[model samples]
Target chain A: MCELDREIRRWRRQEMRRSSLSPRELDELEDHLRARVELELELDARLTPARAFAIARDGLGETSVLSREFARAGAVRWRRALGYGWALFALSFLLPALRFEFTHEPVQVLSLTGYEVFWAAVTEGGFRHALCNLAMLLTLPALWRGRVRGGRWLAGGIGLMGLYLLATGLSLPRGGGGFSASLQVGYLVWAASFVCAAVGLWLRAREWVPTTAERPEA
Target chain B: MKKPVYKELVAASSRPMVLSILAGGESYGYEILKQVKVLSGGELEWSDGMLYPVLHRLERDGLIAGRWELTDEGRRRKYYRLTARGKRQLARDRVSWRAVHGALEMSWGGGHV
Candidate 1:
């Protein structure tokens, strides 16, 4: 009986693993399986052949290929992705706005100085730096949407690049005394991109394919 | 004893029998098979391997729960038990079964008489 029980546990674990059940879900399933085994033992003690056959008939009704808990997990993953995307978008908008608000006067002064001087200052900031930041901002939505053919790799790469850009931006000299119009425009663009990314991610992650028809009950 | 009817009997008896067993207490794979054999007087036997699928389904439906535990002898065991919902469902099932049985008897017997 113990050997059989071990085998059953092994089998159930394999099934749960295949279903990608998380730690909590696997724990719950293990508990349920254990309870089932105990009940079977008790019934084995009491039942006669015909009655057992009848009981087995009832027990086996409507078998499913996947556990309900695991089935719901896919939806949960999509929701998490959507949430993360929205959070990043919110942060993207908030951080830049905060920076602008704190140094509004300097930003207005910088804005009045015309594009040539502004461009020169930013150029001193380096093309690679600006390009990197721009790329990071642009890639935010792509990462958030995360459904392109190479989405996972792309998102990972973009995330790394974004981190690098952020680190570089922080390390760069804060030469311009305050927020410039160019900086404001850059901030707005980044915020807009983040919002778009959030929306895109939400759309992509949403289980919009009408799962009702696919539901077992349906 | 014919193949098709034998198959039908096997199919129909699987779930209710398992549910009934769990209604008593928790059970595992081999023991469930053994109990079924005993209950049916060996007339309605099931392949030992096929029981897991049914068990999995029942667990999925939230009618039963399963867990693993170790015995004093250092042996691990998986057990299953009925939830409150399952018990209520069993009662409803009993009522429905009785109704169906009664209706069948009334219709079939009235004609014979």
Candidate 2:
């Protein structure tokens, strides 16, 4: 019974890897798997490896190989997308902070310092930085189009944001001084834009798109 | 007369042949292919790559089950066999096929006369 269960698992893995099984094929496979489990419960001696293999080889038709290939391709696509998303998120948050630090501008209040400074930066510098980040986040939607389009938009957005962040940090007032009224307004716009872009991108990610190859016609 | 079409052979033998082969004993991938070829007198040919997916579907359907075992030869092989449900299914399939065959023969005006 244990051996039979192991074989069933092996077959299931193989099926997952093959990926080309039609809905009917998948249904049939599930049925067969269940039958095996039932037979195990019954402790049937007829459920030998030799016999099971014969049934599988003969009963399963020609499309099995295609299904396996499709499944493998899908797994690869999912892993790639997940990796991309994580990297993008990390860079989105970390790059701005890094740029502000390296530039060493006096007006840049949001240094790696006390909570007061951090909050000050968010309240004062947050708007401009957020705007730049919002623009960066917008590129995420274009990513849904295709790899090339998404990559282009993401790269362009990130590059522009980086430049803007560097400039803003360098131009900030020093000695705990607040930003000018015009700078504050600009910062608010940037912050609002960033929030909107982030929300939009987050919503877009929820939409289902085929990460794997196109499904075969029935 | 033209040789039996590959499609016709496949369509005709799909279930009965599969069940019959399993009736002998549990067998794995390559062994099943070898047996089928011998049983069909070398006429029925299935590609090696195509068999695994079908096997998976059959396993999925509860008609059959599979397991991996290490042979005395020290190689692990995946084997499959019919469940009780599969046996019952085979019996039903045989009846239906017999009816279809009977109709075809009757329409032809009797057995290979």
Candidate 3:
């Protein structure tokens, strides 16, 4: 292909990083750009493809601005995606709890489902454990809004909590070896919630990374 | 030579103009833009980059729809046309535009025509 086509392809590749714009949207945009160049050429035969491409590109708009718009649009969409994932996971946690909701004072998940481990967390775990889950829940909105700084906060929060759990779980069992296995399992189960929060934060963090065009603003 | 229209004026009117053009039939960016220049005799000078955002904003607002089609020559093109909602919006816009046009014309003492 010509330089103009090659440049258009290159721009599309860069724009793909935005993730908000679908492949079809990018294809449509490229077609629109190509059409603009063709319009320039039709008006003046002597115009070089590069010159025509430049004019067309200028008229079509900068890739960065367009990408920002797309990114903004994408962020709105990602909220829903993050929301669905959170909802499903939350449901997995809440579903078993539903039947068990009012019936049990301190709930026990009898099923061997991997997710019962999550339910056991909220009901059987201590106040501090529930507080960690609460922190994880609250940080989600900030991350859903696509704030990278919040991701930083989330990483620090979850990492410290995870470390704390390991320290305490190992040390608290010094009363005897009797409490070791069950306590370790409980710690793992509760920490899984923290892990879920971290994973959610990580997904949004990808969206938070500044594009080459946006980094200068920082 | 004609005076260039104010940027804000172009920004203000471009949406109605674009929506009205789409009401005529399905057309792509390049064609709609060229038509605007030809129809206005170059008075409505808009930045090249601004139109897409306007179109996108309109699309996002659900006033229009876009699709891609391959031409007889085997080239793919993106085309936009009005929606029913767009048509309803256009009718309302037409009334508003005419009111503004009448007011301006009356101010200029051309109301009798």
Candidate 4:
């Protein structure tokens, strides 16, 4: 690598240390900086390495400013992901297992003993619903984890989720014994959210893409 | 030579401009900035890295999405493209831009009855 490239890389390392962004995000930021530098070089053949680096850095703006923006974006999304994920988790057990034990409701809860509750949870539709919530809950972390380091896995996960949603949406209760319309709509909403999140995550996932020769540090 | 664009206008319009441009097709950061300069006849000068924040925010809001891919020149570039949400956003931006232009024309045009 050239002297300027080394300097740029060192500067990136420093910024990455100070920033809370993930490694993938840091790599992306570096990619952006390099792009600016290359563009500068393309437009001007006579510029010195130091001069070009300065111009590129200046154009990309101060590291702190860019870092702050990325940090904020990451924080906000993580918070949303955590919140949504936890809510699903809490609702799963609270609405089914805990509600059965605490509220004395015989409708949803069949067994008073531990084994009975376990069996009921597995067999009962309400507990099954809660399990679905648990599955949704897992998507949040896996989605982001996949975004950072597992692009192909995330793509496959989302693809499977899409298939599941399609199957569920298609096989709606065609006038069941005790099936409610609102519950059906809830399934649609949950499935739609999953599909939306899956699509968004799939688009952002780049780990599976082959590293180009230009990505020296990658 | 055209005069430099005001910083605030450039900052404010970056989101809509990016969304609108991507609506045309996918492009990387450097290419997008170059297109903006050409489209403005070299009038608008966006602060070098300012668009990154805007792009990040849009992605967070689900307005646009990006991917890192190889170019024909063997350079790895982060390409941005409009998402379905971004398309809807551009439609809104188009209406708002037209309204602003209409207002400006009405204000600057010859006195009307």
Candidate 5:
């Protein structure tokens, strides 16, 4: 509300637009700066508010270096979260994810685990689908390493695969031998992995977004 | 009043120092910096901004947990406390530090080699 506080707010806004740090990080840094500014003022009664603020900010280090350090730390955190997602995805395969029900006289029923469906897709005419799955799997490592291109590719892959899964899960697919395939509980769990990856990527992207106004460097 | 000459040593020791401080209780960034200065007798020189990244790393590694709380003055401040994992890490770190300290003490006591 005061003049110095307004100046600090302006500085925070500029840093937020220019740096990759999240708003929470900017807030934390702002709090630290304010504390240091107060201490500076206390140490030297002759120092003006602006001078105190400048001294405190300088002691906090350059924004460029701080941003770089935060980016590195964020990458490690994101990679760890992605690793857990990949583990969940890998484990989903061992669960029965689909059920095949025959409308024949015997009313026979068959169930396939995620692993079976994966292999079935590979050997069957769904080779293209298998390739898509493999490509999505490959994107995991690249995305984990915080590569922008990998994040984009993985987002696209998740979108396409999610749509495909949703469509298939919502409708009973009629195949040969009067059999209809319905998604089971395990299938939903497998689909949850996509949700996990999507959320992780979304959070990572949310961490850095520049404002439209290009304020000149402070 | 002598500033540490070795930047690497300062950086390496920061983690253990912070862990030991947090082991006493939860504290915020400015308070932690103050404690570090006091504990080091003003010998440990650290830029105010350098501590956040280290804290973030510690939080990410599960060594410390950070949470935001409103002070009685209505100021929102982030506080950090050591986790169980961090206590274990501090114990291990203490062993390593003492070993190095003992070696140095024995060598220095002889006043040579």
Candidate 6:
């Protein structure tokens, strides 16, 4: 991180020590302040970090005023994890994904959760399905941070895979069964999960476009 | 040659102004501030701290919803968007503001200043 970045973080920590503002609120303010500083720096190449930081800080108004405004407005501490929340919600739907029936002998029915199926796939060399799921899971944090380029489409593709699995039952490696497999409600739920993620990511992407586009190249 | 808008008028208009801007889409504090500056052509001056309270109040009234999200640069920002309730409120605000504007236009047009 640059010195200005460190300074901004330190300023946020200092405000947290003395203000009624929640950490999340402070985080918002900090980003606004940092944006102001970036604009200031970009507008004038000769501006020092201290000068730019001061300009941004003062532009944000006093901490006391902000606290009072928040109090008067009845601001409450709240957190939102848009993309992450949707991803986790999607993962939860996998709890009851598949039902297995044995047509041999005494007609037995066995239900398997997504977790069970995942492990079964892993042990049975069903690497393709396992890897796809793993890749989706691994990409979430990056998506949350907006680090993933073309993220909305990536999320949509994940949703499409879930839809494919829903339409066609989970394809696992041959395990010597004389039974047919059908997708359960979990597949549908997972599809909903991914759809939610795609929408959430797209909205997130939309919110930031103008800001980045408006920023003057320095 | 821009005339400064009175602080009272700004305060009175802040709620609808925010609702209207957010109706475009979800936006963060900084971006919203920039929009206000641009749209008003810098005639309306709002302190950065002043807007958050308005946002908080709107949220308290269920006129808007705020969420935290990271920018592509990984900076955390709190984005606010109009709720269904907020849209309805904005519509009502439009009707009232138009009434006021029309009344003023009539008076000004009739040389009543």
* Interface DockQ per candidate: 0.04, 0.03, 0.12, 0.24, 0.18, 0.28
- Best of the candidates, lDDT: 5
TM-score of chain B of each: 0.78, 0.82, 0.90, 0.88, 0.94, 0.95
Tell me how far the alpha carbon of residue A82 in candidate 4 is from the true structure, in angstroms, after superposition. 5.8
Candidate 2 DockQ, CA atoms: 0.03
Q: In model 5, what is the error at residue A123, expressed in angstroms?
A: 28
First chain TM-score in every candidate? Answer: 0.34, 0.27, 0.40, 0.41, 0.54, 0.55
Question: Which stretch of 10 consecutive residues in model 3 chain A shows the poorest summed lDDT?
Answer: A209-218
Q: Lowest-scoring 10 consecutive residues by lDDT in candidate 2 chain A?
A: A207-216
Residue-wise C-alpha lDDT for candidate 3, range B9-41, written one tens digit per residue: 888898899998898899987788887888788
Real contacts retained, model 6:
0.62
Summarize candidate 1's per-residue lDDT along B1-113 as a digit string, tens digits.
52333857677667777888888888876678778889877777676446665776677677788666554543445577888877877787778777887998999989965
Q: Which ten residues in a row have the lowest lDDT in candidate 6 chain B?
A: B68-77
Query: Candidate order by TM-score, highest to lowest?
Result: 5, 3, 6, 4, 1, 2
Model 2, A167-192: lDDT tens digits are: 56435544333333123323323333
Per-residue error for B51 in candidate 1, Å, reads 2.1
Query: What TM-score quantifies how close candidate 5 is to the native fold?
Result: 0.65
Tens digit of per-residue lDDT, candidate 4, span A5-33:
68777875776455434555556666666
lDDT of each: 0.51, 0.50, 0.63, 0.61, 0.74, 0.72
Show model 1 residue runs off by greater than 4 Å.
Answer: A1-218, B1-13, B111-113
Single out the weakest 10-residue window by summed lDDT for candidate 6 chain A.
A208-217
Model 2: lDDT equals 0.50
**Sequence-dependent TM-score of model 6:** 0.56
Identify the runs in model 6 with alpha carbons over 4 angstroms from their true place: A76-218
Model 6 Cα lDDT, one tens digit per residue, B3-89: 799999999999989999999999988889999999999988998878888888999899999776656786666788999999999
The alpha-carbon interface RMSD of model 1 comes to 14.2
Residue A96 C-alpha lDDT in model 4:
23
Model 6 per-residue lDDT tens digits across residues A53-117: 98999988888778667656843221123455355545745667777777898878888776776
| Per-residue lDDT of candidate 5, residues A79-147 (tens digit) | 555555566677768888889888888998899887888788788766754664665575564453344
Interface RMSD of each: 14.2, 14.3, 11.5, 4.7, 9.4, 6.7
